[model samples]
Target: MKKILVTGSAGFIGFHLTKALLERGDTVIGYDNINDYYDVNLKYGRLNELGIKKDKVKEHQLASSELYPNFRFVKADLCDREYLNQLFKENKFDYVINLAAQAGVRYSVENPQAYLDANVQGFLNILEACRHYPVKHLVYASSSSVYGSNTQMPFSVHHHTDHPLSLYAATKKSNEMMAHTYSHLFNIATTGIRFFTVYGSWGRPDMALFLFAEAIRKGEKIKVFNHGEMERDFTYVGDIVNGVMAALDKPATSNKEFDTNIPDAGSSNAPYRLYNIGNNQPVKLMDYIEALEKAMGKKAKKEFLPMQPGDVQKTYADVKDLINDFNYHPNTPLEKGIGKFVEWFIAYKDSKLK
Candidate 1:
């Protein structure tokens, strides 16, 4: 089994990805700072699911999972270059997945330095470690928000992502550039996955799905941004993790037919590639809310509000490259996904009450 290092293993997508890897019999080393960006209990709860006792976790120390013998975890920040270097020296990892970053567009506006420290500086440290340790493949998370102010429907990997509206988006775009540089200079096989509105069980509380559910449960009005005109290609976390695995298994190769004269943004002559892993089906905000309402069997109080800054009107992914390269298709229906999330939310909330 391949030995993989998954950064941000305590976060939403990272948690799901690490669980899948462990279940598939791969040896995984999970790393995360477990900061209080959201509820620390939720982060601890995810660790608990991974068979990691929160009390046993200590900074810069490795903890083995009780359930998965092949799984181990370390509570460490990515910016700790010395510890990162030491970790890489100790573990000759076959593959690396960098998912650790300061998430959320609105939060970036309030705390730009957090994005710089985590997404920019932390990612640089990962690149450096990968350069020294030399992993077979390095797959990192890029967001559809990188599309920024592009009015284009179905954002393609080939589209220019120069006009990022938010600091978070800009940082993600910077990661793509950084990865390309490492791939070109060091011949590191790197792939960037641009996720579009990923949601499912154990999702982040800051996301709309969880927020709306909590607000509805508390008899509070759910905030409808852009006056309910927003749309998102709400992909299932299961589908996203599947796509990630598909990419991880296949290291990026130089595009044989690449033309430097007319460069392709999606693929390069170097061992670098980018793909958008999305549902390819955009659901309107109101319709998404309706699905949640149906799942929970509760009507939501609505509060229409102006669109927040650094937020996009809609995001639809053009996953043709992803399909052609990896045969990945996100098939989870909106209603079905919502149903699964609502069930999990209720159980998790009730468990906390006890």
Candidate 2:
């Protein structure tokens, strides 16, 4: 069984991916700061699903799961160099998935340093540890936000991501570049997966779906950005998890067809690759909210507002590369995904609110 280090394992997608790997019999170690960026309880609640008790997890210490012997967790910040090095040295991980990042667009505008600390410095730490410790593959999270203000029909990796609208987008774009540099210098096989709008059960509260659901449930006016004119390639969490695993299993190899004269932004002659993981189905913001309303059996009170700073008009993913290489396809219907999320939201609220 492969030993994998999944950073940000307590975060939404990271939690899901960690559980998936363990279920497949891979030995998995979870690392996270468990930052108060959102409700810390939600992060702990996710750990509950992995058989790790909230009380048992300690910072910089490894906590083992009784149910899953192959699973363990360590509470640590990504920028903690000494701790990261110790963990990597001890584990000798076969795969390293760097998902830890300060995640939010508007939040970044208010506090850009947090993004630099986690997304930039934290990423550098991961790359350094991997360079020294030597992992078989390094898969890090990128975002469709990197497309930033690009009104392209579908944001393809081949298109230029030089124009980022937000600090968050710029950081994600930096991650792709950082990964490429590591692959080039250290011969590290790196795959950067650009996630589209990911949402589902146990999703982040900061995301549109969760915020919309919470506001609707409370009968509060939800701020509809861009006056509900926005759109997103809303991909399901399960699809993203599967896609991540597929990418992790295939280590990047040198691209012989790559030419420096006409460089492809998606790949290089080095052991570096990039793929967009999304449903490739762009849904209007109003349509998405309507789906949630239908699922929740309640109508939303939308306060239409002008586009917020660092917010994009729409995001559509081009997963042609992912499909051609890994045969990955996201088939979760929008309604079905919303139904599951709504169901989870209701149950979660009932359990927590009471």
Candidate 3:
């Protein structure tokens, strides 16, 4: 079994990816800082569900279950360069999938430092460790927010992404560029996935689905930014995990015949690549709210608000290259995905109250 190190394994996407990898009999070393960026209980609750005990949820290490026998957890910050280097040296991981970051777009506008610390500096450390250790493939999370200010329908990797509107987007773009440099210099196979609005069970509480569910349950008015007219390519979490695993399996190779005269932003002569792993189906915010309302059997009190800063009107991913390379396709319907999320949310809320 190949050893894989997954950063932010306690976070929404990371948790799901780790579980998926373990189920497939891969040896996974999961790491997360367990910060209070959202709800710590929720994070621990996910670990508990995965059979990781509460007492072991601290820095430097713990194991989850005897059932897997191949799963380990490390509660550590990515920014700690020394700790990261030590982990790399000890584990000698074959694959590194980095999903850790300061996630929200609006939060970046308020606290840009968090973005720099986690997304920028932390990622730099990861890149350095990967360079030193020589992983087979390095797959890191990029954001669809990097396609900011572009009027292009269905954002494609081939398109120029220089006009990022948010600090969060800037950081993600920077990661792509950094990965390209590393791939060019060291021949490291690096694949960056520009994820759209991902949602499902055990998602972050800060996301729209979780926030809307909580507000509706509490009989509070949900803030409808952009007057509920915004659209998002809401990809299901399962599809994203599948795409990531596929990319990891197929390490990027240098496009030796790549033309420098007409440069392609998505692929280079080096072993670097980027893909847009999204639903390709943009759903309006109002429609998303309606779906939640139907699932919960309750309507949310709406507080219409103007579009916030660092927010975009729409996001649609063009997954042509993802399909061409990995035959990746996202098939989960919105209603079906949201139904599962609502079911879990209700059960989780009820359990918390008891």
RMSD (Å) per prediction: 0.6, 0.8, 1.0
**Clashing residue pairs for model 1:** none
lDDT tens digits, residue span 1-354, model 1:
999999999999999999999999999999999999999889889999999999979999999999899999999999999999999999999999999999999999999999999999999999999999999999999999999999988899998889999999999999999999999999999999999999999999999999999999999999999999999999999999999999999999999999999999999999999999999999999999999999999999999999999999999999999889888788899988899999999999999999
TM-score head-to-head 1 vs 3, winner:
1
- How many clashes does each candidate structure show, in the order listed? 0, 0, 0
Candidates' lDDT values, in order? Answer: 0.96, 0.94, 0.93
Residues 1-354, model 3: lDDT tens digits: 779999998899999998999999899988899999899999988787667887977677666664568888889999999999999999899999999999999999999999999999999999999999989999999999999999889899999999999999999999999999999998899999999999999999999999999999999999999998899999999999999999989999987778999999999999999999999999999999999999999999999999999999999999999899998888899999999999899999999999
For model 3, name the residue pairs that clash: none
Instruction: Report lDDT (Cα) of residue 75, candidate 1.
Output: 96
Q: Give the TM-score of candidate 3.
A: 0.98
Identify the superior model by lDDT, candidate 1 or candidate 2.
1
Output the lDDT of residue 313, model 1. Answer: 94
